[model samples]
Target: MLRNSPLHPLARFLLNIISPLEGNTLSAVKNTQHFVRIIKEQHVTQQDLLVSFDVTSLFTNVPTNKALDVVKKKLSEDESLEHRTSLSLNAIMEMLNMCINTTYFQLDDEFYQQEFGVAMGPITSTQRYIHGRL
Candidate 1:
């Protein structure tokens, strides 16, 4: 099971480092309530437009390379990263890439590799990074 996999701990650790940095972004919202409150507080005119998108197959369709690039940029710019963890930025990125790219699954007697996007279940940390960064 993925939960017992060696990379799972590393994914969780990286999530800890990345989550804090992610939540500090201006676009980050605590929840739907927070987002709604912010929208309500805004002063808007008729000319101002509110827009939203319906992203079909959002999780499976996320471009992995683009997500990694964004996370790399965020990690590089984080001044507090050294205090947060001893792992160098390069090391963290490498492990993250390994964890994400190395994902595969077994079905009965068959095994298959995921060619795109992180798996949709269990790996909530990876999902958060993609959702927050993108």
Candidate 2:
């Protein structure tokens, strides 16, 4: 799938490394949810804000290479391996890749005329819900 596709190469590499990490994905999702909730609560209570500005094209503004690099470094960190963080990393990476592919194809990008690769991580359904927009 990586050999002939428009998806970023770094995304593919991360997917390869994360394929073996088993449990990290769910934890990552939960962590993100927790983080978001905390932020929302803080905004509501501390800032007295009921509305938050969500900027679209947020991910598009993130350089794909940089995002993949951060993921790769985190996945390969000694602390992560020692604590078995790869599992969640793998699951999240796979989920993100699926989301990106789906979004890309939905945009009718001519370069994205291919099927998504295998799903190797856990929390498959939840991941889809969390990152379906990529």
Best candidate according to TM-score:
1
lDDT for position 50 in model 1:
92
Prediction-by-prediction clash tally: 0, 5
* lDDT (Cα, tens digit) per residue for candidate 1, span 1-134: 27766678888888888886667777888888999998999999999999998766566677788989989998999898888899988899898899888776544455555667867665444343333211
Q: How close is candidate 1 to the true structure, as a TM-score?
A: 0.79
Model 1 worst lDDT run, 10 consecutive residues: 125-134
lDDT of 2 by residue, 92-134 (tens): 5565655444432323232222223332223233234334432
Estimate the lDDT of model 1.
0.75
- CA shift at 69, candidate 2, in angstroms? 1.9
